[model samples]
Target chain A: MILSEREEEWMTAYQNGDEDALERIYTLLKQPIYSFIFRCTRDEQLSIDIVQDTFVKLQRYKHHYNPKHGKLKSYLFQTAYRLMITKLNRRKKWRSLLPFLAPLQQSEELPHSDRMTIREAVARLPDIQRAVVLLFYYHDMPQEEIAQILGIPIGTVKSRLHAAIKKLKKELEGGYNESGSL
Target chain B: MSQDPFKQDRHLRTKLDEYHVDVPDFPMKPSRWIRFINLLASPAKDPLDPLISTPSGLILLKIAPIIGTAVVTLIQILMFL
Candidate 1:
């Protein structure tokens, strides 16, 4: 799709070191960006913090951005994922120390809700699987694109996606069996 | 292996898309501390900052590596002697 003139202008001005332009782009993209990060981390607060840190990184490394390689949206998502991984790693360290920090509260379980159940099940997945699942289902990205974005091999993406799907299948079936209808 | 995993389970794909998560907009202002930092580390945009652009300055920049190596070697040699 053709970018609106405003988006193009924002990108042009942003590339030229305009802080206002950066803020404008951040306002425009932050929801979808937060959605992408929230799907990965599943912690609303942590995702917000990571999204903020991602934009700061974008501002600091603004000079390194190349408009030719890809769309600004893709670059923003990639940077956010990298920052999210760093934050998750730090959280892992803190978990080792405290050991009693409550697990992130999960989404409310709904009655006979296949999708919500699957989504909740996916959230309970290990980090890499959760990332792969969300990037696949939520972003609607193909396996190859996901591999490129996450810097993993296509084979790894395929395997993780396969495993994730299997896990979701099990969760859906179990939920369905209890409810006696899908 | 199947063309559509969703085909086997029927409602799977459609249902997968249903669980909408609320993605709140992150509130952030480039705070004063951040502004001060950006100002401090901000690159000299002046196309003519000598430390960055001039030939003599460039040579000094290049010489920095050689000088660093020589100093390290001298210190090591003096320690041995």
Candidate 2:
């Protein structure tokens, strides 16, 4: 994912404390970030919150963005990914401590549409694999960038994508049975 | 033998395109920003709140006398002087 020169300029300006540059960056990246999060969590509100938090984190940790390290988009995605994992872990712990208060978990019903099947299969993926798949396919990021965003080796990213796609194929083709085998 | 799943990548991409999850308009509501700022401005929780909230806090409370003895002796000597 080579960023355009204009995008890099905006990022640099934002890093230099240009609020307008920050706003532009937000406008450009918001939808894709939100969509990535929405697909992963399947929760609209939580996705929105995470998007906002990602930017706020960018603002708060402005110095952390170094072009020498990576592109701003990759940095933002990395921040959001970490935040999403933290939120999911916290939710899991809360659910375990207070089962009654946990949100109703989605049932493993056979999806009616191919799109729905894809969505369900994605939501069911282990967190790391799902992140890899979303960044790779939907975001059109190269495996190297995904590795940078995930802080994993490109080989690990490749393997995760392979495993995730394999699982999705199984789910979509086999359909759900009473036993809930994928 | 199972088919190569990568062959289905195109299909998955198409399905992903068809999947419509509405993205809300950005530069989120000002009220939300206000709330976020207020949260930032709000006083931080007491540092010892976590320690005191748990059994360790109770243990600290029990040992307060033993911990305070040195300070108490210093105060007594200062007062006598």
Candidate 3:
């Protein structure tokens, strides 16, 4: 079941020590939270670890959450983003030596031909544009919400979205006639 | 011999949107009491933690003011005596 508005309320209550609310919110948003983290990290073990740690951090510092700031999901995403940055930094040393952290055709499921091409095209964009694309299309976020999440201007979101779409179209279409399916 | 690249591809967007993969979960099952005890026993490593250091450093931080007050009070009492 989708996370209901009541469930979001209950999550805050759970953070405030309502035990029953804890179980309810866990069942409600756990999968989506896991999926979001997984997409961010692109590592299953790390994503699960981060999700668990995010909830732990949430519970441990419930007082730090300012209701005036935004919705519970927004707070959660911000927290996860911070944690993901930390994880990436920590993994940097190891990643440099390995040089294989990002590889072609490495997505968990061997993506179909079209999907693989799209992921490759996405991987080529600059980091900010890549993040904008992921947050916009992957998360199904609105332009204003994407701005809030990325701390970029709404105009920037529009421009990046436009540029990204154009770039992706160029790359994808370059492969279209070759694939003989489009 | 070429398609209009500026023409937006709604199908591509929809296909990308539908891209879903099974992500494995790394679930943590630490009990609350154990987690709490671990929290209390281990010095917090978070940058914001007040006691993010050796026990002596934390003790020195917490009791320094009280110790200063006590020492001054003791000196005053001794002088009066």
List model 2 lDDT by residue over A31-146, tens digit each: 88998888888766667788988988888888777887777778889988888989878868966776545454343333455333666777778878988888977787878889
Q: Which ten residues in a row are the worst by lDDT in model 1 chain A? A: A102-111
All predictions: root-mean-square deviation over Cα? 17.4, 10.9, 15.4
Give the per-residue lDDT of model 3 (tens digit) for A59-135.
Answer: 78877876566666666766776787787676666446644432212343444454346656665666567667777
What interface RMSD does each of the candidate structures achieve?
A: 14.8, 9.5, 11.8
Q: What is the C-alpha lDDT of each candidate?
A: 0.70, 0.74, 0.64
Q: Model 1, stretches more than 4 Å misplaced?
A: A3-9, A100-116, A178-182, B1-9, B30-81
Best by DockQ: 2
lDDT of 2 at A151: 88
| Chain B TM-score by candidate, in order shown | 0.40, 0.29, 0.32
Candidate 1 vs 2: which has more lDDT: 2
Candidate 3 residue lDDT tens string, B17-67: 655758554344535575455435532224424564678778877798899
Worst 10 residues of 2 chain B by lDDT: B38-47
Q: Candidate 1: deviation at residue A103, Å?
A: 7.9
Instruction: List residue ranges in candidate 2 displaced over 4 A.
Output: A1-3, A105-116, A174-182, B1-10, B26-81
lDDT of 1 by residue, A119-167 (tens): 5676667778878878777776667667767889988988887787887
Error of 3 at A109 (Å): 14
